[model samples]
Target: MGIKRLRYWLSSLTGQVIMVALFALVLIQLVGIQIYRMEREATLGLVNSRFTLQRLVSVTRLLNQSPPALHDEILRASRSETLHLRLETSQPLPDERSARFEHIVRSKLDYPEPLAIHISAEHNPRRVHRPPWMHPHHRPPHHRHPPRPDIRLQGGIELADGRWLNFTSLSDREVPGWSAKAVLSFILLAALLTGLMIWLLQRTTRPLKELAQQAERLGRGDKAEPIAETGPREIRDTLTAFNRMQNRLDRFVSDRTRMLAAISHDLRTPITTLQLRCEFLPDGEDKQKIQQGLKRMEQMLNATLQFAREDGLSEPIRNLDLPSLLQSLCDDLQDNGHDVTLCEPAAVIYRGRPSALRRALQNLLDNGVKYGGKVQVRLATTPEQVQIQIRDFGPGIPEAQQEEVFKPFTRLDSARNLEDGSIGLGLAIARTLIHQHGGTLLLGNHPQGGLLVRITLPH
Candidate 1:
């Protein structure tokens, strides 16, 4: 279940867009941090190099002018916590010169002769200790060391007197901390950008959402309102096509209904003529059979005409009390000596064609009372829909014949009597009306013993 839910969320357009935006933001932030680090390092290196070169020139000039005894005191004055300088009598000359430092120093100096120089760097030990107030459990299992600083400039230049003047100088420039205001500003900018992207996505997709809803209404046999051709060119084109399709469908349905009505009307004249001719015939078994055939034909023509007339979309929809409607229907049937009962009646207001819906429910209740011998009407409502179940106590329909029974003029031999005018159009008309209301009419056998007709309507 968890995996299925996660897949569903990931598949949604909103989730995909958010994920992409988040990834892009992370990538941008990473690149920005890297560029900032590189710039900061370059600036720090340039400043430190200049400071070291100046100190080196000063130390060289001081040694050349002062006596040997004063050299020790002068070197001591230069030493401090951040910088350490000393003069050594015997020290090994470094194998290589610091090319960058040499270039900078030579550019500034105007010495008469070439000066021998060697520069090298030393690594400092990292301080690793927990704060005094920190609990032992909170401390890391393994100590994490801070990053090592850049190498210190430790080398000496040849003095004019040939007395070795070795000195070490270290700069105390630390990397600057990130400003709180800068971090806050970046966070705000990211939030604003994300919101803007979301808004744009919604705007771009709004037409598609509307189109989907309109298509759903069309599928449910409901009248769909024409959507405005707005948004991008592609979206506008799509809406135009949808509107055309809706018009075509409406025209087709209207033409087909009119054709059926015309055919029925045209046939009624001949059927009436045949009935009039049968009245003049002599009374016999053959004549009786002819009359019955004519009567059946007339019944079929009338059913077709009625079906075409109630095309489902012609009815205007309005909010009505569904429970009250069912209760009233059950009361009417009970007055006619039908064993019909309504259970747990509660107020349920729903939007639909009240007259059409009443006819559909009436058909189901009549079927239940006729075939099942007794009718139990139950109404249930949820936040999204209303459901009506008409249950019967008679022998339930066989699974194989349940669907067939809903077709017009289809009758199960044991369940329906042809002589009783059971033309088998009840379930068909009921289902048609229910579907027109954007609802479902389903048939099922009750677990205990009878047939159940379940109707669900969107609220």
Candidate 2:
């Protein structure tokens, strides 16, 4: 397939819409997972920060007491609503180390400045006066303080009243490195799978569309063969069905055509024999009548055989000058003294089964001369189509009866009276052959008081 057509199929609104919807769904799912992970991380951060604060408060209280043993009773007594204190006999760090230590603890509790709490000495706490420009609505600084930096505990929480507590440690990065890699890999794999599905779906649909086009051509009576059966199961089955239909139709037409040709062929020998025997009759008025009847019978048989030829059997197409052929036919009829005239005599080359087309045209002219008392043949052409008209001057067939007259053996009363030997197969066979040639034959009443038969052929 050409790139243009393939793109057209893929971009068809239905397929494009489906693909877009699926891709959007996958994207939303990925985004949702990421959002959930971020929210979980924030929750864990709060828990870890609160736990660190409580641990510092407990160890600082323990050092202030300078206990012989870090007794559980002393730790319990120091506990308060704002802080939990722990006493231990550990030497105080040097001033520089202690100062650096405080910086790290303050950094760990890095809230916005307004939410920060100050740690102060238990006795004679350093004066903390509000700044002169502080907002009137702000409250005084609270007594409780955050944990010192040096202490480390598994987890803890500090309260405003100097109470503290601890809890087990936990990492907020719940999704591990391997898990994140796996998830990303899955998304890429899913994208690849989705692309493959789109390609396969489009490939399957293309042949089905082609098959539908072929079936339409067949319905229009143009020769169209079955497509190659290859695709998904549904498309393959549809192609198989189309092939089967073609086979059945071909067989049916072939059988009927053969039967008709056989029956018509069998009648010819008898017709010829009858003509020969009619000649042996005594030369009287009765013999003359009988000979005329035999000749008409022979004509009907010939017409039938011509109709059968429109079936499976056909001559190979070749290029021929249409104008020359028509002129020749006109000349032969004129020599026979039928008023047959050619409107246009220029050479026109066309590809066709020449013999079949010639016979069809000749039959129309014959009917014109036989009943219309005269024949006028006119030919015209345009870029897209060709038209031939044969008009007769006899009493024309009624408009309603024109259609019936085109059926085999359907002789109109007027037609029968005009030609006493009318078998009514002439127009029928003409129509069949014209249709086989991808043309149409129509009957209309001439404005000049006669029958006008028009044949239109596509270029």
Candidate 3:
């Protein structure tokens, strides 16, 4: 579960930017720390060498000036926790190259060639003492302590009488490193920069989010409102194109609807005149046949006019209680002696054109009762959408002809009887209305031997 959540977080744009920024900051900090350590070590080494050289020179001068009997006392008095001085008898110095401190002492000596200086490890026969900076876990056991601190400088300086003055000095202090406050400050800076970067990225991507939402609304057949042309140039250009396309689509639909309405209105006058003429030509077989043809023509024209007028785009949209609407429809059908049932779980409200939706649903229920004997309506709701299922226990449509039934003026021979005054435009009109409300109407065969119509509407 933890890994799944991590993957989800990483998939977002904000997460990706934050991760990259943090990684870059960490890498930079690591490099900076390594460089700082190297420079600090070099600077401390130089300063320590200089200090050791000055201390050695001062102590040597003091010992040479003091009497032979008081030299030991002076050395003992000079010994401290951070510095150690000792007087040794004349001895042969080991052959070894002088370290950093030895060079400083050599330059200070008056007779450089005659003076013998050898650097050796600081060894203590007593208990080992660890530095305060060394962690407990990192410290070696009593047997295997690692080398730390500076080496001991052991050498002899010749006096005027040829008596050799031997001395040893132990360095006890180390250079200071970075403090805790410095590390904390670095981390705080990195966090602040990362937060600033996230804010800027969110601001840049805000327009893209709005664009995506607008496109989705257009796809769902809802009216697309114009968005403000703000942000970068690329975002503004894209939004401008989308607005232009939306305007063109709206104009095209309006023009086509108006043209169809005009044509239907112009044909209605001739249709009425022909119907009146048929009334005057009476009482023969040929006359009756002509009258029947005229009547069918008139019905077709009227159905077309009605279809063109119910173009839901022109209807006013508002919020209405859907369950109540379905229950009321069922009640009306039941009063008319039709077997209709409504299964509603609760009151559900939806935003759409109520009158247009009512006409569409009424057509579906009427079809169920006309062809099939009984109709069952069920309403289901979810967080995102609502579903309505209308089922009928009639001879279902053939698999090949189910889709064809939705085309205007098309009917299945095995399903709906053409003699029942169904111009075959019912399904098409219902589907058109549902689509205008950003919904879908689908027809399928139920598993229990009937036709099922499912309507889905997004909230």
Candidate 4:
């Protein structure tokens, strides 16, 4: 698929719904986890800070009560892995960012200058080399470990004798990491929800698909069975309306055909009565004119009745080889001494009313031979439809009357009269039959002097 089409599919209802749901789910999970992590870090930091303050106060009190001679040893004993303590005469500058923390610590300890509080990552211990004057067996350099990037808190507190006691400690972190179990749960939940959404979409759109199929059949004049009203309320209502419309179309066609047939049948009796009245008159030009008029009326009535019967035709559709049908039709004309030529087409299997389609082709072929002399027939298939071209070697129809000939009871030559065996329904009936099969029958004048009848049947 191309990018544009894929993007269009993603913009559909199911795609949007699934995308929104998944986005919301991920957003909620990430936000919730982040909030919990922040709360956990805040609680841990508070407790650790209070505990470190107490330890600092204890060490300071012990140093104050002890003698000056024991100060160095006391400070050395207080030092440990987590806490590094040192004494300096000059006080280090206090960190501006930790002003509130400094005030709290100074108030708790009392009798202190401004305290220094700052946060940073701890650094590795410095490496040292022995001096050249030292003995050959010199003391080994201090052992060093890889530096850690964990948070380290440091502070400076001034004692009563104006000595600064600086201390460093690593921040205690107890926040748990996101686990594999949580990840698996999220994946499984998203999958389940996506599957449920797809199922629901299929159920909702299935009825709509059926409605579209039936609509196509209806356009082709096929009496499709009514679809079962299913799906959501809107879909059910649409199907119901479509079914009612189909029923009404069927009724309308049937009623019109029946009324036409009835009128034509009733007119035949009057035409017969007129024929009897003309026969009783004396043999003269007027008597002959009356008889001829009655005969024309009878011919017109028969043609009308036949046209009505075809209008109400309810033939069953069947699968047939279209090329074979055309070949047989041409062969029949040839056997009957008609000048018919056929260009054999490739095999094409099509589904339609075979009888109706045959009659339509026959009409076109008959017109070409009877009115225009020799007929040339050609059938070919395109990707989308089947085309049949029929041309004759006689005076072609004029441009103005090309479309008019397709109308019922329309004659190309007014002087030809009804005796020529044409009630002008041949083109009309052929076009009607083709239309009923969702095809087209077009009339045009051939450049080489003959009428061209082109028919296209969709695959």
Candidate 5:
């Protein structure tokens, strides 16, 4: 689970950018440290070489002037961990001379001519302590770093007394390197940079996130206030365009609704006048048929206008107890002699238009009760959504007509009857209301024997 979350985080743009920057910073620090060590070693070597030359020259001059009895005291005083001074009988010199060492010695020494000298180097491997974790016999070859070899400069310089002065000068590889501060500082720096990067990215992207949420609400046909034009110029321009489009759409719907209302109001006078005229007609079968047709026309017109006016979008949303609402709905139906039962559900607080949700639930329940005899409502909740299930007991809708029945003015031959004063708009209006609330309504045939209506709302 941790690895999955890490992968998900790394896949984002902000995460990738931060990772790259951190990687570059670490790489540069490492390279700088390495270069620093190399330069330090070179500087130490130069200082040590000059000190070695001065000591050799000083010891040679003092021994050349001092008596044989005092020479031993001088050599003993000069003896130390890094140098060894001794006087020996004539010894065979090397055929080849170290030209660099010879030149350096000559430049520093003012000794007379025929200054014969031979320089050689010897290497001795350093001993390293074994860590407690590593076994003696089972030691791994690549487990630890290899020890450095110690370099000792072996040289013989002839003096005026016809004897050779031997010296061994050991180079100190431990040049005491100094680097960055405590380990805590590095850790703190990395953490500080990571947090700052995340904050900047979130701040820069916050406006875009709001834009997406508002656009989603708009797509669901819910009314939203105009959003602030924030972020970069391109993003601000996009937000401005979205606000304009929403305003224009709202105006268009308002105008169309007003026009429909005016036409409906004008038609009411003529319909009433015709009804009064038919009142004086003879009591004939044709006259009764005409009157019934006009009445049906008036009913259809009224239903259409009611649908237009009571679309439920104009109602403001608020928090309400959904379980209480369901219990009340079921209690009312039961009081009216309908066989509807609601299981006692846990309290669910939700935010939405109360009137719209109530109307939608009523339509689904009515349709279920009208076709099927008994109705049962159940509620379930999950982390992501809330679901309401309505089941009935009579024959359910055919599989093919399930989706077809949701269309406005669509009625099936079997259960959708005009005798119930259903203008084939209940399910359509219910679905529209659900969608506006960012919810879904679906119809399916229950395995037992009736239609099942399922409503799911995002939480």
Candidate 6:
């Protein structure tokens, strides 16, 4: 049961659309995270020998040589790596001296040749003397390792020269939270748009649902009202079509009913005249046969009129005691020399059209007495529903033919009496009446070798 319900939900168009939207949202978020991480990784760079430590030493030494008054300015400028100053000595060096200087440079920077310097000591007479051990290879006591940069802003990467360079930066200083304000705003917008779409979809589809319900009701012999016209152009047109069809169907039924009623009405007068005419005939076999034929025709005309009238009855409902009604029917039959008994617990009140219900019950009782010698009627009620059963003691109708016997113009061979038999509309009319009261009439075999007709009514 649970799995069946789940399958039905999954099959619905609304559920499928929602599932697709959620999948797309999750996919977009995942892609965003991957791109963000890739951008972060691209911004971090590795160190190289050409960007040697000697360049940093030269720049720092130059900054230190500046005048005391300009010291703060130089330091501040150096922090942003904007400074670009040249270092010039007082005299030219000999070839041997330059070569020795290059070797010392290699030993100090721990790399070969190329380097870049940024500050100049032009405004100061003396450069800050570096201790003999203060070479590029000689790491400073305060610098345990190269400084890491501000990750949230622009991050800095360390060069082999011991200089740090700022890399890619984010435009915003602070990242926004996807919390109450943001979420609420998104939800409000989505809700407004979704509501509008839902309304439009329902407008287009509601008539279709109503039309389906109408078809079902009609199939069950119910005269449901036609669908109303309201919605989009397509839906409105469809509803209009359905209303036209219903109107045509109603007219057809009306015309047929009127024709049947007219034919039966016209024939009744002649049948009455013929019946009277036969009564005065000589007392012989030919007269008796003619009388029987006229009687049968009258019975058919009467049954047709009754059926036509039944279709026009307004189903005005009322509350009545079902047990008492069944007992009354059984008692009446018994008093008329029929073997009918009533089995009831107590008064069981139910809501239904009383007159129609009585007619249905009467038809069943009549059938019981006509076929079976003994009739047993029983009533039982539960909190939720009520059931009345009429059992007859005789050869029951065949199981295969039980459903067939309830159709209009149907009669069992055994029930047909040459002397006096009905036109075979009783069961059909009973079924129609029972259905109007929102109940069911079922024919089944009785356990005690007879037929049982059960009527069930819901509370």
lDDT of each: 0.76, 0.65, 0.74, 0.76, 0.78, 0.63
Worst 10 residues of 4 by lDDT: 125-134
lDDT (C-alpha) at residue 18 in model 4 = 85
Model 1, 65-172: lDDT tens digits are 888888868766654433445565555666556777766655665444555666665434233232322223443345474232334666767667665566555443
**Per-prediction backbone clash count:** 0, 12, 0, 0, 0, 2
The order of the candidates by lDDT, greatest first, is 5, 1, 4, 3, 2, 6
Assess the local accuracy of residue 139 in candidate 5 as a C-alpha lDDT between 0 and 100. 35
* Residue runs of model 5 more than 4 Å from their true location after superposition: 1-28, 38-101, 110-113, 116-180, 191-199, 212-224, 259-297, 415-420
Model 1 lDDT, full chain set: 0.76
TM-score versus the correct structure, for each prediction:
0.84, 0.49, 0.73, 0.71, 0.74, 0.59
Worst 10 residues of 3 by lDDT: 119-128
lDDT, candidate 5, 1-459, per-residue tens:
999889978998788989997898788767877887778756756676567767888888888899989998898777654566778986556545567776677666676668677765443424324322222343335736533324446688888888888876655565344436635666688889889988988876777888889987776567888999987788789889989999998888788878878878988889889999999999999889879877877877786676666567788878988999999999889999999998767568887889999999998888877878799999888867889999999788899899999887788868554454567888888998898788999999898788999999887
As for lDDT, the candidate ahead, 2 or 6, is 2
Model 6 ranges with Cα > 4 A deviation: 1-113, 116-226, 269-281, 317-352, 373-389, 413-419, 435-440, 455-459
- The CA-based lDDT of model 5 is what? 0.78
RMSD of candidate 6 to true structure, Å: 12.0
> Model 5, residue 187: displacement in angstroms?
4.1
Q: Give the Cα error of residue 377 in candidate 2, in Å.
A: 8.9
Clashing pairs in 4: none
Pairs of residues clashing in candidate 3: none
What is the Cα root-mean-square deviation between model 3 and the actual structure? 6.5
Model 6 shows how many backbone clashes?
2
Residue 446, model 5: Cα distance from true site in angstroms: 2.3
Candidate with better TM-score, 3 vs 6: 3
lDDT per residue for candidate 2 within 330-397, as digits (tens), equals 89999999888988654567766687788889888888888887888888887667888889999998
